[model samples]
Target: MKKKIRIYQSINTKIVLVIVLLLVFVLQLIGANFITQIENQLITSFQEDRKVQMDFLESTITSSLEIEESGEGSETSPEQEISSLLTEFSGSGITDLQVVNSELIVMGTSDTTQQSTVGQLSDDVDLRQAQITENSITRQVIDSITQNRRWKIVEPVFSSGEDSQFLGAILMESNIESVYDQISQITWIFLQSSAVAIILSLVLANMLSRALTKPIKEMQLQTREIAEGDYSGTLKVYGEDELGQLASLINDLSDDVAEAQESIDAERRRLDSVLTHMTDGVLATDRRGKIIIINEMAQSMLDIDQETATEKNLLSILDVEDDVTLRSILEKQDDILVNSRQNDIPIILRASFSLIQRESGFISGLVCVLHDVTEQERIEEERKQFVSNVSHELRTPLTSMRSYIEALADGAWQDPDLAPRFLEVTQNETDRMIRMIQDLLQLSRIDSGKSMLNLEIVDLTEMLDHVLNRFDMMIHSAEYEDKKYQINKEILEQSIFVEVDPDRMIQVLDNIMNNAIKYSPDGGTISGKMEKREDTVLISVRDEGMGIPKADINKIFSRFYRVDRARSRAMGGSGLGLAISKEVVEQHGGHIWADSTEGKGTTFYLSLPYFPYEEEEWE
Candidate 1:
């Protein structure tokens, strides 16, 4: 990764560069103005000095000319007298001097190099202009050959009289190199001063930039730390400035964010706890129906691992049809029944959907609550079957009674034997229906927890003997004489006492014995055994006959359930005997179960807790 530049360094660099550039520009502008002013002043002074020198030279030459003209005995010529004065003035900073007459001829010269050209016409423009205009003229020029700057001044010399005729012009040229040299020296000094100022400005700018950007850089670092979830450090307030205020605000913001995060984390933990411990499965999806969150129950219910389920499309995992998307369910606010299977056992889940929406009324995602309703649905189906079975059972006996009564009503009573047989059949069917109804009422009472056992300590051995003897007497009678049913008893010799309602216990024992007799073949042995265990007395009834199938053994104790429904109904069995027996056993703090094998006999086992009989209580 490329390294990041620090904010302070960048800010500092830019600030310093801008300040330095501004300083350099302003300083240079001042320096240029100052130099130009100095050069102009120096040139103006040099021109004035040249004009003064020329005026004095012109006055002296005219004085000499007038004095010589007035003196009859004067020997000096006008040109020689003027040349003597010009020579004196040329030595005083003048580079060249010349005297011109009215005819624009060079009358006298102070330059030795040009002395041979005396009496030559003056080719100087200013001198010719002075002669023509009769006015003094001054101009400055640079010498082409020497490349020296010079100023030229020309003045007309007049006669010393009232008429004052213009005699000639005096022209003088002086070098101004010294003034240029001074101006150059001053410009160099200004440049040096400007360089020093710029250097000082740069140093100060760097320091100032540091001062300005140091706090801002600290704030930047603090903000970055805050972003990474650290709100421990605070920036030092350097001054009561905008940056300082900003730093304070950032610190405040950090505190607020930390507090908000803590609250959010706490809420998240609470939600997680609820999801973890909830019995129902909960699933959350995104707007696109991708799974975002799935709790443990959801994972277990869907038989999916978290790693495989997360971020996968919800519809794909659910294997729902196209029309049953999470969004559609949420929008319709409907509960869906999802049918699935685990371990080949059908599972039914009732899933209620709720929409997750934003504050702006936009749907963001969905939440589904899944409840396992398999057991409930099975119970509902069983209840329906029970009602149907009850109706069928009642309808059969009623139909038989109705047919027999109708036959009697249709004059069967006139045939005495037929009418009597028909009447007997009706009476038997009525009794069977009455028995069936009584059994149904008893079962209803047991289910509603309204049947209470009257507890009494009694010898279980005597109870078993009493039930067996009742069957034995029935077998000995003429009704069962052709089919031999034998009772074999294996009673515990030691008396085992138990606390139970004697009537209910007898009812249970009778039901078991009757069932054994009903399923046993002719001459099959029905065995009864009473064994005392460590904590309870075990009473079991066994039959040697065609045994219950393995698959029907578990459901034999259910109400209206029969191993052979047709045979059971033909034998006047209500199919609730074992069910009632079980309820009675359980109500007495005992349990009953069956052990059966195909092609072998089935043993119905009843366990009752032993009671230590006190003599007084037994009495």
Candidate 2:
């Protein structure tokens, strides 16, 4: 029977049933309480009315007894007065009025059979209140005769107010059965009305329940469709209640999810575009080392077809070069993008993955990406080779000059008088070649980013002084050197020291000064000066040279590049001074540039950031 019921089959029906049951239970409880109260009131009202009637009879009987004692009419006994009182008691809604004497005799009654019962005495009558009260009492009394039938009331009559005298008790009983019958009829009407009300409530409840559940049922079906991966369309809802609002939200959510999915699909396609046509290879892996996805490029790099690569472990498929930077990136963190090349073909690749967590944040899967860099590597290699070739070209001349100076020093300078003259000339030429070779080497290392600078504080004034002493005799002679630099003022004691690589910077300054001397027409004024700016120091070396043409200023720093090669070689120039100077200044985190105009002087200015080295290291 329980199995046949299908309790969960109809939600609306069940809810309606529950509502109707609860409403009916409460309504019935109220009706029962109402009926019980009304019945009690009816009984009390009927008994109270009967008590008044009995009191009237008692008063009349007591007055009559007084009259009898005074001899006003025919003097009657107590029993006779009671019997007359009972006989006179009359009302249509009442019946079976009777009276009894103190002796418990049936003196008289409205009906003869009831009078006979009166003589027997009513044991059910609550006589205690009457006995306690001087006047009258009223209460419900169960029928003394039939047991089921009820009576109204009875009252005892006293002889007089002053004297201790006994008078008969006047019992006036009314059936009140008709009032009870009327109440029964009304109760039947109430029951009928309650039945109608219950039926109506159940019907309304069922309708309400259906109205509530209809949209919910539709939404439930739609949700199942969504769960089953149906993104076809959306559900439309009616009305403006809570369920309608819920439907609107679901519709919006579905649209957003669909749009988001399309966007994701678009991104995947874009990624595929880059991966499929690229020359180099790419491979991706999951947290468990399984291949989650791979671009065609990656598949090609590993030398495996896509069909064969799916579900394979990444570590197994990848043919990564032993010393590639990608190995460090991949081994460092769990799921960040790392780059690597699988073979010597020089493929640049990026891989990214994540712990694919569910809503509860449990790790589930991983993802990765790839790229190619063979062309890039080739270009970089060409640049390095070009720089190396330039360095070798500059070194050969310096090497030849050094060998001549060595041979001249070994035997040619041994004759005492010729020694001083030959040694000085040889020393000057050797120094010039040594200076050129050292400048070329520095330029090569700086361009390759292979040189490390000693970032320390050095006195700029003292360094300049030491270099100045080497040229003191030339500056003082002024005849053969033909150049004289005048100290304009007392050189400022630059306690304003800067963080610099002094040796590298000296090489830079010396190159610029040599070029100035080499290119300047005879008897030209040359100048050197230093000034501090907001965050850097500027050193300027200027000469009134045969000024550069406008178009050629940009190319002056190109290697093995010279303006008027014959004139530069005649002045013992290596054509690498300005080029090397640029490299050294840039390596010191500084800038060097030339400003020249037609027939005007050229100024090479070098600027370096004022690095404060004395402050404590934050690291």
Candidate 3:
């Protein structure tokens, strides 16, 4: 946006003022010099005319004084003739005229107001000086009464002889104010002409300035319009001068800018599209770490709205300000695992930071790419846990078998009782390890989706009855003589046939029944049921034993997860039965879950797809 240019600040006004001032200064100097020379010439000419008149008056007065000195008589006395001559000699600019004798006595006077000074000693200093020195004297003075300028002249009259005698002196006073008045008039005329010249100069300067600044003003308007995204206007070139060349440049600049604008807009749209479709959340910040641009993915990942995220500090928005600072991130330029929660659900984000730097190596801001790593991190953690559990489980059995084998090898075989017992213990541990390894391999295959089920149609109720009969037989066997238990079966009259992998389905039921028997107390009844539910059949195994905690019930199906690790290990359970059962049931298009309460009992349910089948077709 262009600012409004004040009239006084405009280049046109400046040029006009500069030209006018230069003219004024030149005129002032010329006028002063012209007036001074005119005044000097006028005064010099006036003095020369006054000197001529005084010389004429002195010669005429000398003839009259000499005649008196020779005692010659005339029609009038010498004083009368001198007075007549003085009166005739006096003219304009002459204020007073006096004739004095050699003795400095006034002989004649022309001023009527000073006629009484005749025959009196002349008190005029110039008159007395002229008689004593026998030379003329002239001086100009201002009259105190009229405040007018006057010139006083005293000329000594000499007789015409080889030895001239100073007869007397003629004194004259002349008003010379007219000389200065004429000089003043001439100066005034010069001033009037200078003023007119200055007026003319001002007008010419304005015209010249307009010619020079017209194209410049147009260029200014054109540039302003270009800045406002209007590149249609072109500056009119007035001449082939500098301003015209500049106007041409401006026109070229507008064309270049229009092309650049289109290119920039296309690039911006492409960038916006890329940011919108990016799977990874991306955010950009200014040098101050304030969020400048945040894409939709970034907003979603951060769980922030566009309005709330704008201009907000990036670290604060990511909730990592306490642990990480912008400077640290910029300096390190490393990826940060940001542990955060959105809507109370814990999530992990891999925030990769990079510097937005210029070619000059100036760090302008930071760009952060946020990748939601919550599921990845969870899977990674589970992998680590699985490795550790497998190591520990293998280590326990291997360590036990190693101890028993070492005991037997170290002469324990000499004692038949000790050797057989150690051998038996070693074999049992080896079997446990083998079973664990098999379960681990099976789970790996299932997790990798490489396990295939041998699908078949099977009677869900008959499968449940077969699983219960085994548990019933185990309860009455000599091995469980001390631990009393009972089996309660609720089988539906109409058999529910489900499409399943028969072995896998039987294995799933075996895991449930075994868990029930292991956890049941003496005389505790293990209840089994088969029922058709919607288009599926549900088989539940209930145990009257201390149940799993509600918190850990959901996680009971995870590989190697045991609520009581010591008790489960002591009972020789591999802890993979339930995990395997879940995978098997799910693979056969069935679901398995457990319902439990602390200090109560647990019910494990398995639901498989059910279909009404005609047994005669198979027969």
Candidate 4:
């Protein structure tokens, strides 16, 4: 949005104001000097005119005094002649004129009000000063009664002789206020003319200001539009001047800015797309280690929302502050493991760090990429354990076989009793090793998805009966005479048909039955139950034997796991039966689990998905 400019703040208004101010200042200075010179000239001319008039009147009075001395007085006395001369010479400017004789007495006066003092001795200070100095003296004073300005001039007259004698003096009072009034009138006229000139200057200044600011105002508007991301408008160029060139430059700048903005927008969108789709979590932090950028994957890995994650310290988010500091990570630039559990699920992440540095080798921030490695790390650990278990399992039997073979080679074979027993023990150890290897290979195939099931439709009732009958046959035989056991079968009378690989299913049953028989006491009963449910057929083998502990029950199906390692080994068990059964059952789209009472018994159940089908259709 374009901001509104105040009238007082506008460039146009400022230009107008500056011009008017400068004109006023110049006029003030000129007027002061002009008025001063005019006042001085007027005062000087007024004084000079007064002096010339006073000198002429003094000479005429001196002539009157000489006539009286020569005894030529006829129609008028010397004093009357002097007074007449003074009255004749006194013009518009003269207020009063008086003639005093050499005795300091006023002989005659033009002022009627002062006629009484004309015959008396004149005590005027100017007249006394004129008599003493024997020269003309003048002083200006104000009238006490009228408060009017007056110029006083006293001229001493001398007798015409080789030694000039002071005869009398002529005193004149001139009203000089008219000279100041004229000067004031001229000053008023000058002020009127100056005001007219100032008004004209104001109008001219306004026009010039508008002309100077028009282009600038247009440019300002266009620039404001450009700032608002509207680059379509261009400034009008009035002439080939600085303003015109500037307008052209602005148009070019707008184009450049628009292109740069588009490019930046495109790059930003591309970055967002890449960050959204990336598999690994990405995080970026500023130099202070506060998170500035975090992708969705990073948010998920950290179990944080964007609002919570932004500006949070990187170490705090990763929860590795106790182990490492930001400086350590930056200096090492190494990968670290983050182990966190959210919602009771363990999450393991491998975070790799890199520096977000400038070309000048200044490090600005750090970038961390997190790849989830939970499943991979678990597999790696299981692989190592599997290898160690296999090594130990094979080594035990191999060592036993080697021991017996060496005994026979050292002439123990010659002893009839020792030879048979040692050979039998060696043979048993060899068979155990062979069985363990076969089970390992079977598990490997199942895990690799190479063991395809030979599926067939079989009646689950008959399948359970078949497995039970085999165990029953084993129990009845002389080989199991010492360890007597009973097999109890609880099969659904109605034939329950299921889709399965018959051989694998039999193997699974064999594993459960053998475990039950091995753990049960000599007179223990092994109960096998089968039930037809809505969507699955469940088979459980219950053994009257010491049950698995609660803690180890979940791990009973793991490879190479045994509750009693010494007893299992002594019983010629490879410890892979349950693990193999679990894998096969899962491959067949089934689940296997166990339930046990610590001192009473354990039940192993296998459930396979089942759909109700017509028996006739399967036949």
Candidate 5:
């Protein structure tokens, strides 16, 4: 398992190992430096001790010369004493010692081997070439004089006496045994420390690897949980460090994942409900051209009579590409289209997409939906047709009336008897056409929703009185002929003020009153009455005239739609009277209706909201 992990993993282990190896290498370098220092010091000490011994021996030889010059035991054999002294000094780091004289003759030596003598008299050929003057020391590795198995350190020496005289030179040859011993100790120390350090470093490396890998291992586990769609918080945090920050970020990511999952679930449920209830069709597909899901409406639309469209091809079922908008939206990573089409129908559907990314941030899948809006489009078309028809009907009559009026003014008035009736007829025709035009203009304004009404408080009683007086002359003239022809009005209360457009209210009442007068069938009673209710005031104009049938009641207020077209045309109905009245009532935020029994009478009621309905206005 360990080998497998290393093979498939990144180089984290390698980096740590490299760092540890560098540490061990530096330690060994330090140890090597310490050993080198000890060796240099030892070598210097050995050389200095040898030089000191040579100096002491030279001083002893000089003392011997002085004793001889004083003539005290002058013949006591100087050679023997010098030889003994030199032999003793030979036991030191210097293996051999010799003294040479100025005569270049044989001098007392450290050994009686004759070849160990410093001068030529001893037959020591190598010793004769040794320097006699200019004191200097040098070391050489040559064959040892007494030992056949090793080499020696040969150091040359000179006396520091008069004439730099040849009191004789001192030569020392050191055995290589001590140098080998010192070198062996250093090598042993290097091996020992190297082994100990390697073992300790391995232990530390293992521990350090675990310390660093532990947090990352936890992170790997958390990442696996997230990948498996288990977003519950399980991140392990240690302390306030880089790794701690990573843990915090992971925990935050888990929370975000949970929230995202909830949002997706909610959106899914909402989408499902919408698909089930909506009259439109919905379809979803994946990135590789495979169908993911399809709603019932969509299935039915595409002639697919199954419970689902899962694992199918969308294009195979939905051969129609009329929904270009939805298709374009589905083509993007994420998009929304408000208007999409169907095969043979125009639809406005809202569609959106979400790109699915994998571990490497590559595209994975796609989703789509569709909707239908055919019925709503048909209804709107019908309304537009109706408006156009109404316009035509109103315009035709006005056009004809204007033609005759122009004709009558230009020549029909030339004949006196013909001219009087013609001009009167023309005036009435003009008046009728003007009323139609005025009604048309009002209806047009209402249809266009452009008419702004200036509303104010209106006293119903005062308004009625003012309207009654406008026809006072006609009322008074007909008093002698018939009392029934005169207008009659009744009021139940005073201070009947309401919020209304006064002029529009007057126009509505005028239209009703004119219709009453023109189509009363015969002399009849024209009566007006006001009734107060909890929230509104009702104004009624009743006349013994033709009554409207129940079947036409619903359409009575439609523009250019008249009941009893022949009688309405004879009575000079503009066909927009009730329509304009309806518009005016609605503008004041009120209502108007008619109540009557055919051939009995007609009563048009205008209901208005009290200016301050909530207030105790009745008081």
Candidate 6:
């Protein structure tokens, strides 16, 4: 469980408390001293008043004594005169007044309750001390009988001569309770004032602390907003003080941070756009060779998950050797060609390395750009093979023609039979060369997308029949005098019409028939079939001969591809027939494919969009 904090513990509350406590302490100190001084002054004033009264009574008594000695008032006794003077001073604020003689005898006292003490020896210690010293003495005492606090003043009355004799001591006592009452009342007033002062101090301190802390609290809230990624808030300045200056700085900082964040976000968006649309794969790594940034192209090319690849080692993800880390690549500063595979298909990637460096020349990381050159490399290899195959194909017939021409020139023409045969052989070679050249030109046009088709609706059944009839005539010619071959046609009874280039379609059919004748054995039968589906016409040419291997079936339609190179060459096949046929069919918005079994036979299929036939058009 978390502990809860109290409001009094907050800075504002603490400040208020501190200010109040200090004020209270100081006020109490000053009030205590003031009260003490007032009490002392009051007690001193009371003592002075009592001393004046005692001096006056002493003067009066001394005057009376002188007159009595001079016989001016001889009728009155000296004790009676002193007693009447004491009586006069008794009720004049003094609690008690006494006149003692030189023998320590009680001459007179103003207290009526102490009348019996008259004419008795005074045992008062104040009087004894005053007679010995012959000086006035004052003392404060608590009355034992009445338990009242009082002041005692003793004055010695002296004669007016050079060696004055002490007549007696005048002892006076005054009750100090009135002075104490005034002090008590003043203390109460002081206590009440202190209480009021403390309350005012607390209220003033609270207000002052609140005024000081309000701006700080607002700044705190603004800072919190900034921490939460909102840099739009600005602090309000309270005064031209340090805290106000801090608020101004914070406001400026917020604006600066907001601008920096905007710039950073704009840069990030631009970088993302470039990475998203770029054709080449891009990968960035940290100084430690850990993956930091990877684009979609990189993920697709590397066959790795973007989320999973992040923070992983770059070399490990690329499947490169352990020594081929990003650090090593950066150090080498060279492009690397990585030969890798995806889904068992060979892929060649050209990876170019660049250093991500700081202005201080410190190498921070590496940037690797990967370009997939698999198709480019494959095309290059194919061009080389095409050139080689064309050279070999042309050289064969050219070599034969050269040899035969030289033989005829060497007098073989004189032998009539040998000359005609040699001429015949040269003509055949010339024809084969012409056929090869024609096929090459046709394929070149098709590949360049320059082949134009003369499209027309043709009767599919009639077209097949015409091609089959030509092959039937060729089989009975001198080329098939010993080998017996047959053409079997299984076409639709109803004539199907299709939109195609008739010449190109005838060429396509003738090429398929020639291949069938070349590969079929002596007595093998060739089957040709045409059928009309819902919206298309399907044509199939099959032969009972050596079938194509499944591995080479997909490549059979490629230019210069041959399952049996030697057999095809011996049969004067340039290996471009089916490739040309595929192009022609596709140019007519049709498709062509082959299906063959190794030990059974081979079949070629061609599909074209079917054209509807009307009776009026046929008429």
List where candidate 2 sits over 4 angstroms from the true fold.
1-26, 29-37, 64-81, 88-96, 102-106, 114-137, 160-164, 176-181, 240-245, 264-619
Is 1 or 3 the stronger prediction by lDDT? 3
Q: Cα deviation of 513 in candidate 3 (Å)?
A: 4.7
Give all candidates' CA lDDT scores.
0.85, 0.66, 0.87, 0.87, 0.66, 0.86
Per-residue lDDT of candidate 3, residues 1-619 (tens digit): 5578899998878988888788889888888898889878887887788789888887677778888888887888899888888888777788888888888888998898899999899787787777778877878888999999998878888888878988888778888898889888988887788789878887898898888878878888898899999999988888888888999999999999999999999999999999999999999999999999999988878888889999589998998888888888989988888877667788899999989899999999999999999999999999999889989999998998888888878889899788888888988998999899898898899989999888777777787788888889989999999988999999998767777888877788888888998888888999998788778888888998999998899999998899999999998998899999988988877899999877778999888777666679657
lDDT string for model 6 (180-260, tens) is: 988999999988988998899889998999999999888878887876789978788989899999999999988888889
List, residue by residue over 1-619, the lDDT tens digit for candidate 5.
1234653264456646766688778877887787778777777776667656656766677665444333367556666676777777766555556555433345565555654444365344344455433345464455545442222222233334454433334444555457657867987978787888777777777678778778887888787788777998477788889988998899899889989988998999998998888776666666665777677777655555555467466544454345443345445634333443456444544344565567997655655555444565555765685577556655656576667667777887687777677667767767766776677677778878988898887788788767766654555575434543657878665667777788888988888887777666545778888888888888898888778787877787876677787777766676778888898898888999988778787888989887544456545
Clashing pairs in 1: none
Which residue pairs show collisions in model 5? 100-168
> Lowest-scoring 10 consecutive residues by lDDT in candidate 3?
610-619
Candidate 6 stretches greater than 4 Å from native: 1-221, 332-348, 405-423, 613-619
RMSD of 2: 24.1
lDDT, candidate 4, residue 380?
Answer: 93
**Candidate topping TM-score:** 3
Q: Of the candidates numbered 1 and 2, which has the greater lDDT value?
A: 1
Worst-scoring 10-residue span by lDDT in model 2: 483-492
> Which tens-of-lDDT digit does each residue in 1-619 have in candidate 2?
1234365678887888888889888878988898898888987777777766666666676665455445565656655775666666766555666554444344556776555565575453444345445345554456656654557566665676787454445555566666688789878988898889889988899789988888887777677666565666576687888889999888887777778878988998898887777654555655466776777777665556777887676655554334333345345534332244445354544444334557986544444544444456556765685577456554655566566567676786677776677667656667767866676677668768788888777776666655545444454574645554432212446555666788777877677766776666666666777777778877777778788888988878876666676676557776677777777677777898888987887887888887544536522
Q: Model 1 misses residue 16 by how many Å?
A: 6.9
Q: For model 1, how does the per-residue alpha-carbon lDDT over 529-578 read when each residue is reduced to its tens digit?
A: 98887788899999987888888888998988998889999888988899
TM-score of each: 0.66, 0.41, 0.81, 0.80, 0.41, 0.64
Model 6 TM-score? 0.64
Give the clashing residue pairs of candidate 4, or none: none
Candidate 3 matches the true fold with a TM-score of: 0.81
